[model samples]
Target: MRLSLAIAMAEEKVKEGGKNKMSDKKWFNKGAKAGKVEKREKLLKTYEKAIEVISKYAVTLFIKGFELSELGRHKKALKIYKKIIKLFPQLNVAWFYKGFELSKLGRHKKALKAYEKAIEIDPQYAEAWSNKGVALSELGRHKDALKAHKKAIEIDPKNALAYTNLGELFFKLGNLKKASENVEKALKIESDLVPALNLQGRIKIEEKAYDAASESFKQAMSLDGANPVHFLWDTYTNYLKIGFNLDSEDKKYQEEIATIIRNLEKMNETLSKNQKQEKEMRAYVLYFLGHFYLKSNDILTAKEKLEECIKLKSKSSIKASARELLGNIWNYRIKPPWWRWWLNSPLYRWPKRFGFSILLLLISALLLLHPFIPGWFPLLQINWSLYAFLIVLLIIILFLPNIKRIQIKGIEVELQSPPPYEPVLSPTVMEEIMKEIEAKYTKLE
Candidate 1:
C-alpha cells in the first residue's frame, strides 16, 4: 500500500512539473466519470443485443404465421398476422396476408383497405395490387378491378397472375373479346401457367369454340393433374354437350361418336389403374357417359351410366344435374299428340303464315269500296257462296296453329311409355347398372 501511494505521488509530481499549466480532475471524480462512461457503453451494447434478438424472432414468427395461413386456419392466421404487424408494423408481407385473409372472410372492403395499406408501404408491391383487384372483382367493381389490375401489370409487367386476373375481370364485365385477348396473352407469356390456361378454356367454351376449348382444358388438366371439383365437372359437361351437338350433324357424326367412345374407354382404363380421382370427378365422368349413351339414343346404356353416377356420389350437385338431363331425355323423346294431326292439318303450314296477306288485301278492297259503297250495302249484296268462302278462310287462318302449339308436341316413344320409370328403374336397374359401373367408380387406391 505504501509503494502504491509513493508511485501515485511521484506520477502526480511529475505531471505537475512537466505539464504546460494543465489541471487534472480529482482522483475520485475521475473514477466516477469512468464508471459513468462504462455504464453508457454497456447500455448501448444491451440495446444492440436486443435489436439483434428481435430481428431473429420476427422472422421465425413471420414464417409461422404464413404456415398457419396456408393451412386454412384463418382465425389463427389473423391473430398471428396481427401480432407480427404489431411487432413489425412495416412488414409488407404481413399486410398482404392480412388483406388476403380478410378477402377469405368475405369482407371485401376491409380486404381492399388492407391491400391499400400494403401498397402504401411498398408501392411496387405487384401482388398487393393484384389481390386488391381480386377483392374489387369479387365485389363486382369490375372497373376498379381493371384499374388495379392494370397497375399491377405496370408494376410487374411479367407477372402472369396479374394478366390472368385482368382477363377474369374483363370476362365478368362481359367483355369477351378483351377477356380472350388478355388471357391468351397471359398464356403466351407463361405457357405452363394454370389459371391463364383455365381462363382460356372458359372463354373458348363461352364462344362455343368447342375443340379449342377442349384443348385448353386438357392443357390445364395436364398441368394441374386433378382439377377442382366444379371445374372438372363443368369442363366435362361442356365437352359432352358440344360433342353431342357436333355429332348430330349428318357428316362426320360417326367419326365424332367414335372419338367419344375411344376417349371414354381410355378414361375408364386410366381410372381403373388405381388413379386418385375425386368423387365429383367420377360422378361427372359417369354422368357424361350417360349423356354419350343418350345421344346415341341408347336407353339401357344411358340408364345404367346415369344410375352409376348416382350410386358413386348419391348426394351431390352431380346427382341433381344428372336428374335434369334424364328428364330432358324423356322430354325430347315424346311422340306427337293425336291432336297434332288435326291441328297441323296442312292449312297452318301453307296458308296461316301468309293468310294475313289475303286478309289485308280484302280489307283494303273493302275500304276502297266502302267510300263509294256503304259497309251495310256490301254485306247485303255479297254472294252467299263468297260469304261461305270468307267463313272457311277465317277458320283456317286463325285457329289451326293455335291448337297445335298448346296440345300437340310430336309423336315418339316417350309419349307411349309408362310414366317415365326413371326413379323406379333406379332400384331395379341397380343390379343391371352394377355391370357397367366403370371401374372408375372405385376411388384411386
Candidate 2:
C-alpha cells in the first residue's frame, strides 16, 4: 500500500511542475513585448530631435553662405551651399542661391543649370525664372530669354526683376520702344530698384532723352552707394557713347561733360582713400579719364592719360583704344577704312547720305556717256563703258563714310561689351534675413 501511494504522489508533483513551467513562459513573453514597445517610443523621440537639430543647423549654414557671398567670397559660398544641397536635395532656396553665386562668377551656363534645377523643384519660384532669363540673355539666346521672362511674369505679375529683364532683352533686340515700356513697368512696381533704374537710364539714352537718362543714372547711383566705383564707370561709358556734340555748346551737353569730369575726379579721390582698388581698376579709370578729356577737347590731358593707359596695359581693349587715340592725336586724325565705316554706320536714312545719291548720279552719267566714248577708242578695244564704270566707282569710293576726315565720334568708339553687373543683394537685406533666422531659431528652442 505504501509503494502505491508514493508512485501516485510523484505523478501529482510532476503535473504541478509542468503547470508552473507553462505559467513562467507566458509571463516572459508579456514582459518582452512591453520592453519592445518602450524601446520603439524612445527611438521615435530621438529621430524627431535629430531632425529639429538638423533643420536649425541648415539655417545657420545658409546664413554663413549668404554672408560669404555678400563679402565677394563666391567660391567659399558655393562650397557651403553645395554642402547644404547635398544634405537636403529638396531645398529650392539652396539651389537658387547656388545659381546666384555662379552668376556672380560669370559662369552663366552653370548658373542656368542650377536655376533650372530650382525651377524643377518649385515651378512657382519667380526669382528663379527671372534669373534664368538673365542667364539666357548672357548666353545671347534672346528669344529664349524673352520666353523665360514672360513665364516669370505669368507666374507672378508683380515680379519687378522679370520686367527689368524683359526691358534688357528688348534693348538688346534694338526694340528701344518696347524696352522703355517694360522698364517703366518695373520702376512703377518698385521705384528704388537699382537694376530697373539703370535699365531705364539706358533706354532713355537710346531715345536721345539725355536729361531723363541723367536723372535715372543719378537715381541709380543714389540707390547703389555700396559700389561707387561701378556707378562712376557705368555712367562714364554710357554718356561717352551717346555721341554728345560738344561743338554745339548745348547747355545740357556742357553740364553732362562737367558731371562726368567731376565724377572722374571723385573716383580718383575715392581710389586714393581705398588702397584696395586693384591695379586693373586704376588703369580702367585712367582709360576713362583719357576718353573724357578727349571728348572735352583737352587734347593735352587726353594724350597724357592715354599714354598712362598704354603703359599699364591691363585691359587689351582699353589699351587698343588708347593707342588708336594717341595715333589720331599725333597724326591730326586717322580714319577707319571706307568699307568698314560703311558697314558700321547705322542703316537708318542711309539713302539720304551723299554717297547713295552720288552713286546714282554717277551711274546715270556713265550710262549717258557710254555710247559717246567708243568701245575701241584706246588700245586693244578696252570698252569705254567699263572705264566709265571704273571712274564712277572711284568717285563713289572717295565719298564713302568719312573717308577723308577721321571722325572718332559716335559709332567709332569700339569699346568692349560692358562687363556683366555684380549680384545685387544688399547687405541690409541679408542682415534682415539673419535677424529673421535667429528669431525663428529662438522661438523653436
Candidate 3:
C-alpha cells in the first residue's frame, strides 16, 4: 500500500510541472507582442517629427527666396526656389515663385509651365492664375490671357491685382471703356494699389483728361514713394504729348514745355546711382529732353541732347526715334542763328536766384531812359527818383546771395544761393539729411 501511494504523489507533481510550463509559454508570447507594439509607436512618432521638421525647413527656404526676389536678385532667387521644389515637390508656393522669377527674366513660356504646375497643385490659387495671365499676355496670347485673368477674378472676387491686369489687357485691346471700369473697380477694392493708380493715370491720358491724369500719377507717386520711376516717366511722356498737341504759339504750350524741361533737370539731380547707371533710362530721358528742346525752338540744345541719346546703346525704337529727329533737324528744320543759340544756352537763360532782380533792373533802366527816348505809350509814366532807388535795391538783390530756409518732413534745411541747374535737395542728399536729423533727435532724446 505505501508503494502505490508514493507513485500517485509523483504523477501529481509531473502534471503540475506541465501546467506551469504552458503558463510560461503564454506569458512569453504576450511580452513579445507588447514589445513590438511599443517599437512601432516610437517609429511612428519619429516619422511625424521628421515630417514636421522638413515642412518648417521648406517654409524657411521659401521666405529666403522671396526676400532675395524682393531685392532684385531674381536669378539667385530662382535657384533657391528651384532647390526647394526639388526637395519638396509638393510645395506649391515654390513653383509659383519659380514662375515669378522666370517671368521677370523674360522667360514667359517657362513661366507659364511653372504657373500651370502650381495651378495643378492648388486649383484655388488666384495669384498663380493672375500671373499666368501676365505670362500669356507677354506671349501675345491675348484670348488665353483674358480667360486666365477672368478665372482669377472669379476665384477671388476682391483680387485687385487681377482686376488691374484685366484692365491692362483691355487697354491693349483698345477697349478703353472696359479698361477704365475694371481699373476703377480695382481702386475701389484697394485704394492704395500703385499699379491700379498708374493704369488709371494712363487711361486718363488716353481720354484727353490731362489734369485728371496728372492727379492720378501724383497719387501713385505719393503711394509709391520708394520707386516712382514709372509714374515719373508716364507723367513726363503725357506732358510731352499734351505739349505736342497744342498750338506752338499758345501760352499753355510754352508753359507745358517749360514744366517738362524743369522736371527733367530736377530728375537728373535726384536720380540714384542705380538709375543713372541704367542706359535705357538715360537714353529715354535724353530723347525726351531733345524733343522738348526741339519744340521750344532751341535747335542747338536739341541737337546736343539727340546726339547724346544716339551714342548710348539703347532700345532700337528709341535709337531710331533719335535718328529720325536728328534727320529732321538736319534736313527740314531751319537752324537758328549763332546769336539766338547763345541767348538760348543755359548761361543766358533766366538765372534762378537773380531772375526777378534782373527783370526789375531792366524795368528800372527803361524808366531811367524814359526822358531820352520817344514815348510810344504815355501810360507807362513813373516817378524817376523812386525808380532810381528801386534800381539800386534791385542791383543789391542781384549781387547779394539769397538765404532761404525750408522745412521738409519736420526737418529744417537752409540754403544759400542754390545752384541754378540742379535741385536744391536731391534724393541722395535728402536721405543723408534725414539720417542726420534722426541721429540728432536720438541724441537729444
The candidate that achieves the highest lDDT relative to the unseen native structure: 3
Between candidates 2 and 3, the TM-score winner: 3
- Estimate the TM-score of every prediction: 0.51, 0.59, 0.60
TM-score ranking from best to worst?
Answer: 3, 2, 1
Candidate 1 steric clashes: 5
How does residue 96 of candidate 3 score in lDDT? 90
Candidate 1 local Cα displacement, residue 112, angstroms = 1.9
Total clashing pairs for each candidate: 5, 0, 0
Colliding pairs, model 1: 335-410, 335-411, 335-412, 336-410, 336-411
Please provide, for model 1 over 211-234, each residue's C-alpha lDDT reduced to its tens digit, 9 standing for 90 to 100.
Answer: 677777777677766443224424
lDDT of 2 by residue, 215-297 (tens): 88788778776554436435644464444545426666756776777777677567546544344555556666776676677
Per-residue error (Å), model 3, residue 337: 14
Model number with the top TM-score: 3
lDDT on C-alpha atoms for all candidate structures: 0.62, 0.65, 0.67
Least accurate stretch of 10 residues (summed lDDT) in model 3? 436-445
Candidate order by lDDT, decreasing, is 3, 2, 1
